[model samples]
Target: MTRLRWCLLAIATLLASVLAVPPASAAQDPAPILDPIPDDPAPSGLGLVLQEVARLPKSEPSAPPTDPRLVRWNRINHVGELPDGSGRLYVPDLNGKLYFLDKKTRTPSVYLDVKATFDPDFFSAAGLGQGFGFVAFHPDFKRNGKFYTAHVEAGNALTTKTPDLTPQPKTGFHGVIDEWTATDPKAGTFSGTHREILRIGFSGRIHNVQQIDFNPNARRGDADYGKLYLAVGDGGNGNVGDNGGDPQNLAVPQGKILRIDPSGTNSANGKYGIPADNPFAGQAGKVGEIYAYGMRDPHRFSWDTGGSHRMFLAHIGEHEIESIHQIDAGSNLGWSEREGAFTFRKDDRCHLYPLPADDAKYGYDYPVAAYDHDPPANWDCASDTGHAISGGYVYRGKLPALRGKYLFTDIVDGRLFYTNEREMKQDPTGQKRAQIYQLAAYDTAGNPVTMKQLAGDNRVDLRYGSDAKGELYLLAKANGKIWKIVGTKQYAGCKPGPKRVSHVAAAKNWAPVTPSKWRFPGREVILAEEGVQRPGPRRPFEYAVLKSGPVFASARIDAEVRLDTPVEISNRDVIIVFGYRDDTHFYYAHLSSDNTIYPHNGIFVVNGADRLRIDQQWNANRSHGAPPAITDEKWHGVRVTHCAGTGEIAVYVDGGARPVMTALDTTFGSGRVGFGSFDNIGRLRDLTVRGTPAE
Candidate 1:
C-alpha cells in the first residue's frame, strides 16, 4: 500500500472520534458569491464595560529603531493567566519583559526579561511581527512548572542553530518557540530551565510567528490534551509578495496552523510528537505538523470554552477583508487563493472577486464570520488603514451582554467589533456568513469613549487577554494601558413614548443657549454670527441646542439649512440636536464638508464630557467615491430620526431615502430638538419638530 493511503487507513478509526470534516463535493460552489462585506447595521445597545487596569511605563528602546512598529509607547501584546489557580496574570512586552500582574492589587512587576536572562541577541529593534509575541501555559503548569513562549531572534543566529523548518532560501529572521520549566510555579519572578523546542525561519519579518497556544478547553484525557498550535505566517510570501504557492504548499510549516504533541517524541525534531490522529500525521510528502494550511497572518485563535468548542482563528487580510475562520482538522483556509469568502486576485490586490466554478476541487475553507476594511472605515487597500484584526474569545464570561458573543477589534484603529457566536456558521457556498456588529464603549464615569480617545493616540495597537474564568481584557501598545471588561453599559434608555406632537415656526418659543449669537431672520432662525462676538460668559461654539417646541423621548427634526460661508472651508458643519437632556448631555448629527477626519461628518453624543462618535458610516468612502454629507455652500434638506426604545438614530441628507449617517446610542432620551452650526454662519428654515412629549 502507498505510504499516504497506509497512514490514512491507520488513523481512520482515531479520526472518527477526534476530527470530523465534511467530505469535499462538487455541489460546494453552485452559485459563487462575491460582494463587499455588509456595513454593520444598528448600534448594539450593548457596549463594553471598561475599567482601568495598570499602565506600563514607556519602554525606550536601547537604540533607535527605524521601523514604525518598533517606535511605540510600549510593545505589549499578549495578556495571559498562569495555568495555576493563584490568580496571577502575565503580560508580555515585545521590548523583552514579561510582567506579572497581581489580580487583587492590579499591579504589574517584571517576571522575566528575554534580553537580560535568556538571550542577549533577542531582536526586537524592528519588524512588526518581531520580538516576544505570545505565551501559553501548559494545562499541567501548576504541577510541572511548564509554559511556552514565542520570540524573535536575529538572522545571525542562523549560523549557530538549526531550524526545524526553513521554507525560504534567504532568511531574514527566526521565530523561536521555547519550553520553560519554572523552579517554583507560584513565584512572582521566573527562575527556570529553558530549552529550544522549535525554530522556524522566515524570509521576512512581518507575519512570521503571530500566536502560539494550547486548547484551553482540552482536558487531560481529551484527544487534544497536550497539542501546541502555532499560527505560523507565510513569511510575507502570500501577502506582500502576492505569491500564494508557499502557503498552499503542504511540505513546509509556513502559513499554516501547526499542531504537535509538545511532550511526545516521534517527529523529526524529537522534541514534539505528531498526534497519531492528525489528518496528515504520517502522510507522504506532507508535513506531519500541519493542522491546517493556507493562511496569511492568523493573528490570534481561541476555542469557545463552552458550546461546540470549535477553534476559531482571526486572520489579518492582505487587502480588503479581516476574517475569523472555523478551523477543522485538514482544513485549508484559502489565502492568496481567497480572502475571506471572496476569491483573491493577487495581481489585482485592490479588489476581491467571486470564487471560481471549480472552487470545490481545492477544498478551501472560508471564514464563518468576517468583516471588511471599507464602508465602516473607507480605507484604501494599499495603505495602513483599518487593516488588522485581533482575535478575541467566544465570551463565555458572566457579563450578560458580552456572553455568547465573539468579541474582536481592529488592531490599529481600536474599534471594538463582535459577531454573535450562534451566528458563526461555515457555508460551503459563500452566501450566508455571520454579520459583524459594533458595540458601544463607555468609561467608568459612564461617558462614551473610543480607544483612540482613551489612549490619546490614533493607533491603539490593540490585543486581547482573558482570565481563567474566561473574562476578557483589552491591552493596547499605544499608551501601555490595559482595560478590563467589567460589565455592560447601555448609554441610552430603551423606553419608547411621547404621543405625537408637532410644532412649527414661532420665534418667541425658541430658546438658544446664546440668544445674542443667533438671529430670527423672518421665518428663518439664523446663527447669523459666530460665538466669537460674545467674549463674556464665553459660551462654547460647540453646538446649538434649541430646547423650544416639543420635548421628546423619541424625536424627529426636519429642516432646510444653508451655510452662508464660502466653500473654501474644510471643517464647517451643521449640527442637528435631539435627545437633549440638558446643556451637559444629548445627541447630535454633525454634517460636515470633510468625512475623512475622525470627528467630522457623523453622529455623536456628549455624555457630560467631550463628544464621542456613535456613527457606523463614519467615512463610507474615500477616492472610490461616496460624498461627504454636506460640502457645498447651498441649502440641503436634512432629517434626523431617533427611536428611543431601540436607540436607533439615522440622519438623512438632501431627502435621500437612506441615512447618510447612522448611530446607536441611549445616552439620553426624550429631550428637545434644535439646530445650529459648529463653525461659520448657518440658517435653519422650514423647521419642524414632531415627537411624543417626554414623560
Candidate 2:
C-alpha cells in the first residue's frame, strides 16, 4: 500500500483505543502501586452536615498580643461533658477561662476562670496549646465533686516553684496538673479549691502537656476506672539534634502516656499514685508512671466505647507524617527513630526509609491510619500541608450513618477523614494500612464547603469533641465557633463524566512552540530535536497546544506517549499540557523515568510567573516524591483530568485506578490541550480529549 494509505488505516485503529474502555482481557494488568491517599478522594454515599451550635465569647490573651493569630479572639482548645448530670457541655479556651454551655440552649457561661481560680501566671500564652490545656471530670463527679485540669506556667513559676517530679531537667516552662474539689456538686459555677497533683519542666513553650482524660469505657468497679492518662509531648526536645533520644528514653515522662490515680498518694511526690499495672511501673531505670513511650506529640486520645473499647491516639508528626495509632500497655510509637511505619533519621529530615530487617524485634507499634503532608501545591502561603491530626471518636450515637466509623481531622487544614473501626487495626506482618476516606462536610443550608472555607482562614486550628452520648462536635480557633454533626447528607463530590468528542489525527491539530524542531510524520507528533533551554523552575522548553478542538472549561485527555531518547539516558521526559491560555500559563505533567528530582517526574503549572509544582506527590525537600513518570522507551497509556470549577487536577498512568500526580488550581481555565517534551525528543499518538466546551 502507498505510505499515505497506510497512515490512514493506522489512524483508524488508534482512535478506537484512545478514548474507549477496552475489554478486561485485552492484556495483563500492570503491577500494583502503593498509594496512601487514593486518586479518588471524593466522598460518596453519606456525608455529614455541620450546624453552628455556639458562638463562644472571646477571652482576652494573658500577654500583650504581638500577632492576631497568636492571640485569636477565642482559643477554644477542647469540648466534652463533665459527667455531672447537668445536661451541659464544657469547653476550655487557651486564653484562660473554662466555659460551660447548656446543650439545649447552646448558651455559654464561665465555668472556671483559670487565671482567677489559680493565678495569672498559670495562663501561658506562649503557645496555642499551652494555657488551660485540658480538663477531665471524675467518673463520680455528682458525688465527689472532683475534676482534673492541666495548664502551663512560665516566668516566676519556673524559678520559685519546683516540678512535682524531682531531679528533672531545668527548663523554660512547667506543665502543671491540678485536682479541684467543687464546693457543691450541683453548682452552676466552680467555687472550689484546687491542689497541685503533678508538674514537669519542659524544654520549650511548644508541645507541652496536651491532654489528660479517664477511660470512660472502664466501669466504676474496674481496675482501670478513675486512672487518668496524661499525654506529654517531647517538649520540642526530639526535634533538636542530640536530644532526639528523649522521647524513646523511658526514664523521663516528657514523651509518654502516664497512667496515675488521682486519689491515691503513693507517687514519688506523694501526690498521685502510679498504677502498678503500668508496663514500666516496676522497671528499674524506667519511670513508674509511663504507660507508653516514644511519641512526638500524642495530641489527643480517645477510647471507642463499642468495639473492643480500643484506645487510639493521634500523634502530630514533625516532618511529613500525621498519624493515628492504637495504644496498648507498653506500646512504643517510634518518633524521632520512626515516623509512621517508615524509618527516620534526624540527619535526613526530608525522606523516609524502609524499616530495618530487625524492625519486628523492636516491638514498635505503627500507625493503623496515617497521611503525609501533601507538599504545598502552589508553593504559596495560601495553603498548608496537612498539620496536626485532631483525634476523635468512633461514633456510637443515634446517627446510624456515622456509627462504626472513626472520625478525625487535620487540625490546620480542617480536612475531615475516617476509617472503619474494624479496619483500624495494626497488621502484625506490617504489610497493610487501614483504608482512610474523606468525609465530606456541608453547611447548615446543605451547601458543600470545607472547614477552611467556613472558618475563613488558611489555618483552621480545628479540634474535635464528643459529649457523654458520643455525638461529635467540631471546634475551630479561627472563628471561635462550635459546630455539631446534626444529620447526614449525600456527599456532592466530583462526578465528572466528560463526554468524549475530540481526537487528533493530522498536523493541523497541534500548534508547536518551536515549529522548526518538530515534524508531523503520518499520525504522530515527533519532536525531531530538543527545544531551546529556558530559565525557570518547572516550565518546559518546547511544547504544543491542541488548538483545533473546542474550547474546554474542564477536560480529560488520554494519549500514548514514547520517549524518543535512548533508555539509558537519565532525566528523559515528555510533558502533557492543558488549560493553556498562552505559552507561560498552563498545567503540564512532566512524564520522566527519573523518580529522584524535585523538578522532574511530576506535575507543573505556569501562571504569569515561573512554573510551580502543584502535584499531590511532590516532596519539596526530597526527590522521592512520586513514582517514575515512565521507566522505558516503550509506549504507555496516560490520562489527565482537570476540573476548572473545583480546581481539581489528577494524572493517572497505565490506566491505574489511582492518580500518581494530583493538584488543585483554577489559574487558567477554558484553554487548549496537547503534548510535547521539555528538552528531550518524544512521540505522541492516539490522542483523544473529552471535555465540556466553554460557553
Candidate 3:
C-alpha cells in the first residue's frame, strides 16, 4: 500500500480499537462497537428552526435590456449591522444595491442604490461572482458617516484615476473599493459623497475585490481601531492556465489580506495610507499595501470580536480542499504551492501531493482548520470533502450552548458545520484534522431543511450574516431569502436534570472505588495504579473509577497528575471521567503520550453498552492536539468543564485557559465525578471539583 493508505489504515485501526468496549463483567454479552464513519450525512429532523424574517424587494430596471441570469445570481450576498443602533441590517445584493432591513418592523427598504446611474446593460454582462461584494460601516460611522464598499464596476463607470482602476485588457472590469459618506446618519436612505479608496483592474469577472470591513468593536484609540482590512482574490483567468500567482507573489495587491488607513494618505500612491504595522508595509521588495499574502479566492472573511481581534479567512480552493485560515500579521499561507496543509502544484492539478513533513520550514502558514475533498467513506463528518467554503462568524449569541464555536458552511452542499475555535488553535500545524459537525437546521414550521432542499438541488451558495445583537443569519443566494437561526439548544437529544451545585476542594473528599493506593496530603490526593489485571474484555474505557461525591449537571474539575511510568507500556493514559450517568454511561479524556506511532489519544463517550469517540480528534477531521511527552515523570495539570445545557465539554491541560480538546454530546445528564485510567499506571494529586449538581 502507498504511504498515505498506510497512514489512513493505521488511523482507522486505532479508532476502531478505541471504541471497543471491554468486558466489564463476564456475564455481559459482547457489545458491538459503533461504526466510526458514516456513509452519508444523517439528519436529526427535530424541527424547522429557520424563520423568514425578510426578503429583498423587487427592483425596477432603468432600462429593460439585460441578461436573465442576473435576476437569479444578483441576489442577496450578506447582511451586516449598521453602526447606528436602530437595529437595522444592511443586506448587500449582487446587483450593486444595499437593502436595509429593520428588526422591529420586519421590513426591507432600499438603503443605497449603486446602480442608480450605471446603465442596466453594463450590469447584464457582469461576471457571475461580480457586483457589490460587501460593505463595512466605519467604526466611527455614527460620528463620521464614513463607510466603504467593494464592488465590480465597468471600466470608467466611476471617475477614479487610480492605477488599480486601469481597464483590464480582456474584460474591461475594475474591482473598486469606494468610501461613501452618508449626508445624514439617521436618514432613511443614503446619498453620500463617493471617493475611490482603491481599485484593482481584473482580468476576469470572478475573483474580484470582495470585502471591506473595519473592526466594528475596536476602541477609538486601539491600534486596529480605524484600519480597514481588504481581502482580494487572485485575479487569475482559470480558463487559460493563469491560475493564482498573485496569492504567492507579494509585490502586488491581489490574493492578499491588506490593511490600510482609508482616511489617511501615507501610501506610495496616496489614494489610501498603508497601515504602518502591516506585515509588509516597510519591507523592501514587498508591496507596502500587502498585509499577508497567499490566498486563491478569499471568498469571505470576518473579524472575530469575541476573540482577540483575530481574522478568520475562508478561501475557495482549486479542485480540492476548501480552507479556513486563522490569519496573523505577516503570515504567508501557501497557495498554488500548498492547499490546506498539503502540497498543490498547478501542473499536477489532478494528483494529490503529500504535505511536507516539516511545513513551517518553508515559511508557509497553514490553516488552523481545513477539510479535504476526499475523505474515507466511513468517517462520520459532514462530508469527506466539499466544494467552496463560506466564511462565518464565531457564535457570540445569548445561547450559552453556541458560544465560542465558529460556524462555517459549504456552498455546494449548503451544509453548516462548526468547530471549536479553542481546538483549532491548539492544532496550528494543521496536521490534526479539525473536527466538523453538520448543523441540522429546520424551517419555522419545524420541518427539517437540508442544504439541498434550500438550494432547490442547485448550487446552494450559502452565506452567513450577523445581526446587531450578534445572532447569526443565513442567506440562500439561489432563492433570495434570508433566514434567522433559532433553536432552544444544540443537539437536544439528552435530558438535562434540575440545577444542582456541588464542590469538593479538600483532598480527603474523593473516595476510591477501585483497586488502588490512595494517599492524601492537605494540598493533594495521590492515587497509584496497582498492577491489577482487569478481568474483562479488552475495552480500554473500562478505567478504574475513583469517585468524588459530587453529582453534576454541569461543572468544572481540575486535577494535577504525573505519569510515573514510561509511555512504552501500551496505551496508558491519565483519564478524567465525567458525566457518569452510571458505570456504563460516562465520558473520559484519555491524556496519552505523544506517541506518533499510535494515534489513539482523544476524548470518548460511553452510552449504555457502547463506547464512541465523540471528540473531533479521532476521525478524518481529527483536531486532537499532538501528544505531549507526558511520561517524562512530570506533574501536568488537567482541567475539564462541561455544560449540560449546551452539551459542550472542554478539556484543558497545564492550566491553559483554552481547551486542548472539545466535544459536544448530551447523552447523559448527571453522574458522579471520577478519575482513572484504562489499565495504566499514574499518580493523581490536587483533585478538585466545582459544578452544578445533576438532580
The clash number for model 3 is: 13
Specify the poorest-scoring 10-residue window by lDDT in model 2: 32-41
The lDDT values for all models are 0.77, 0.80, 0.66
Give the distance in Å from residue 69's predicted Cα in candidate 1 to where it truly belongs: 3.1
TM-score of 1: 0.73
Question: Which is better, 1 or 2, measured by TM-score?
Answer: 1
Give the distance in Å from residue 581's predicted Cα in candidate 3 to where it truly belongs: 31
Q: Count the clashes in each prediction.
A: 8, 0, 13
lDDT digits (tens) for residues 1-695 of candidate 2 = 69989999899878877758666645443322223233222333346889989979977667776555565657898889879767799998887788999868979999898876657567565665778889999999899999988988877887788886532355888899999999897877899789999998887777889999999999988999999999998887665654557888887888889899998888988998988889988788889999988898899999999977999999988666788899999989987788888777666545566676678888888998887765543434233344778898889998988889889988988888888889888975455667666666777776667898888788898999999899999999888999999987643234334556455656777788888888888778888898877765447888878777677877888888989899888889999988888777788888889867777887788887777888756655444556787888899899888877766677878987556676667777767887888779998888888888877
Report the poorest 10 consecutive residues by lDDT, candidate 1: 531-540
Best by lDDT: 2
Report model 3's TM-score to 2 decimal places. Answer: 0.62
Write candidate 3's Cα lDDT for 1-695 as tens digits: 69999999999999898778565554353222122112222222122267777767654322342644444634677887787787888898766688888768658888887766344423424454677778888877887888888777664553444445223345456677878988987777987788877867666666777777777667889888889988877775432344446567776666777888987898765778878888777887787877778877878887777865578888887645777888888777787777766676555444446655566677877776766554444534332244678888887888766678788888767877776777666244656645665566666654445667865656776788988678888887767777887763333333333433234434455555453455555555445554443333223433444454547777777788777667567655767888876666788777887533233456777676445777633434333243442656689988777767656666778866445566667787666677665655676666666666655
Better of 2 and 3 by lDDT: 2
- Minimum summed lDDT over a 10-residue window in model 3 is located at 36-45
Candidate 1 regions exceeding 4 Å error are 1-35, 61-63, 239-244, 375-381, 494-615, 622-695
